[model samples]
Target: MRIAIVDYGMGNLHSVTKAFEHVAGDDASIVLTDDPIEVAAADKVVFPGQGAMPDCMRHLEESGLKGAVLDAARQKPFLGICVGAQLLFDYSEEGDTPGLGVFAGEVVRFPKERMHDEAGHKLKVPHMGWNEMFIAREHPLWQGISQGERFYFVHSYHFKPSDDIAVIESAYPYRFAAAVAKDNIFAIQCHPEKSHNAGLQLLRNFVHWDGRP
Candidate 1:
């Protein structure tokens, strides 16, 4: 099996590649490439990104991999991380940018008024650090991962799916979609590569998943 990690020039590529390498080992060929053909040909595709939405969208289109990404996402087991996850939705409040529309949702910034916790402490914009992932629906990726397990997150915007595809939820001060799964597509707003063991387990499950759920 081969896993292609999409390198759109805006992703946290090296670390993501390393995490997949550690998880898949010799079981799958893990490659980090910007080639659209390689991405389209892989058994599964991992789309990871960082930075602003406008830049990510612009780079993806300019790199000539947008079509390949859309096609792969539609046809194979696809995992999107961080900004990659945000791009799967219809639109984003960040930079007034549009996404790939892989799912019916919009990425919105955490309201300034709601950025404070119950104790009235001000929470940061990019919700960095570890946060619990509360499973809302079951999926293959959630296997062996305990409910409420903390995952590393670093994002200012969050996805709000209009569909019922959300499988996990997290909160800054209020609940929001932490992850969403639909058919062969699974995406998370957190950085699994930085989350340690639970994150690695999720990657392991993805490497072996047959795109069933």
Candidate 2:
């Protein structure tokens, strides 16, 4: 099997590539490339990104991989991480940018004004560190992962799908879409590559998944 990690020049590409290597080992052909043809030829596609939405969109557009990504999301077993997840939505509040629109949703900021916990303690905007993920829907990707597993996260914006059923909610102070799955596409706000065992398990699941909904 072949797996391609989209290299849009915005994310920690090496770390993600290494994590996939650890899981797939020598059984799968894993490559990190910006070439649309390489992405289109893969069995699975992983789109990972970090940084602002505007910059991510810009790089995706300029790198000439945008159509390839959309096609992969529609045709293959696709996994999107962090800003990659946000970019799947219709639009984003960040820089008022638009996304790939693979799903009907909008990405919004974590409300700087209300960045406080229940006890009124100041909460960080990035929402860094490990956070609990409450699985909202059953999917093959969540095969071995528990319902309330914690995953590493580092983001200021979160996706809000118009269809509530598409969301796997997580709480910072309030609930937000921590992950989303529909058809052949599965996306998460967390950095699974950096989340240790659980993360690796998810990657393994993706490798074995047959792109079924």
Candidate 3:
């Protein structure tokens, strides 16, 4: 499949490309681009990012990728990582700025207050390192991942999707949506590229997904 990795001058473009390469084999073609035409024509789209939400949104608007991404989400399968995922929502408290408004609800920060007692330590912001994810129900994107699988996550803000069934939740201080899917659109808070086997499999599934929503 021809997967277009959207480069709005803010994505973790190279690594994600490599991850696709690993899963999709040599025949898989991956390209980093900001061209809306190329992006819209792709079989699949990936929005990868590591930065503040407002700045990322501004770059999207400036690069004219905003419309292309939204249009692609409407037409085909799309995946967003970290800040890219957050942008798919209506708004984020991260910067009090608006998002692409593709999905309803807001992105909020991890509570500064800790909840420690008998279990262990309280979860903190920037839910870094390896964390376990429980696959919520059944989504084609997570077909092979079993219970208690760990994925790499590095983020402070989180997306609380309005669609409950679409959310695949993982833990931190509390359970937050680790990944989300709505019809043709799919998004992940963690970096699949950095998650080893489970993550690669997730990317592979997206590549092979028939865009059935």
Candidate 4:
């Protein structure tokens, strides 16, 4: 299989590429490119990104790969990480930026005012570090992974899908969609590349998934 990692200029492409390389082995050919044609031709697509939403959207547009990314998402197995995942939504409150609108929802910031845990300890805005995820629904991506597996996260905003059925919830102090899955698309807020064993396993599953739910 051929796998393409969309390089729209706003992501830590190295780590994501390396992780896929480690897991994919000889089973697939991986390419990281900003070219839309290359992205659209791939059998699978890994959309990984960091930084702010507005900048990500701007770079995606500037790179001329926006339509390509959307096309790949619709045509094949697509895995979106971090901001890449956030960009699939309708809009973001982070700078009031509009997103790709692949899914009907908005990305909202973690409440700055209610930034406290149950113990009354101050919680940070960027919900960094390792956190456990509660798998809201079963799908091909969760293969061989158990519920409550921990994944590394580093983002201030969270995706709130309009359809709750698509949500794979997680928590900092409260619940939010840690992952979302629709037909042919699976997205996550955590960095599977940085999540060690569980993360690598997730990537491996993606490599083998047939783009089904």
Best by TM-score: 1
Q: Between the candidate structures 3 and 4, which one is better when assessed by lDDT?
A: 4
Q: Which ten residues in a row have the lowest lDDT in candidate 1?
A: 110-119
> Candidate 1's residue-wise lDDT over 70-186, tens digit each?
999999999999999999999999999989999998999988887888888998887889999999999999899999999999988999999999999998889999999999999
Using lDDT, rank the candidates from best to worst. 1, 4, 2, 3
Candidate 4, which ten residues in sequence have the lowest lDDT sum? 163-172
lDDT of 2: 0.91
> How well is each residue in 1-213 modelled by candidate 3, as lDDT tens digits?
689999999967889988997888865588788899999889899988889998999999999988999998888888888899999999999889899888998888887876342487776567789988887767889889888899999888888877674557887767888888888888889999999999999999988888764
Give the C-alpha lDDT of model 4: 0.91
lDDT of 2 by residue, 1-213 (tens): 899999999999999999999999878989999999999999999999999999999999999999999999988999999999899999999999989998898999988787888889999888989988887778888889988888998988898899754547789888888889888889988998999999999998998998886
Q: What TM-score, computed on C-alpha atoms, does each candidate reach?
A: 0.98, 0.96, 0.94, 0.97
lDDT per prediction? 0.94, 0.91, 0.86, 0.91
TM-score for candidate 1, residues paired by index: 0.98
Please provide, for model 4 over 49-146, each residue's C-alpha lDDT reduced to its tens digit, 9 standing for 90 to 100: 99999999999999999989988888899999999999999999999999999989999999878788899999988999999988788888888787
Model 1: lDDT to the true structure: 0.94
Residue 92, candidate 2: Cα error in Å is 0.5
Model 2: residues >4 Å from true position, as ranges?
165-167
TM match of model 4 to true structure:
0.97
Comparing 2 with 4 on lDDT, the higher-scoring candidate is 4
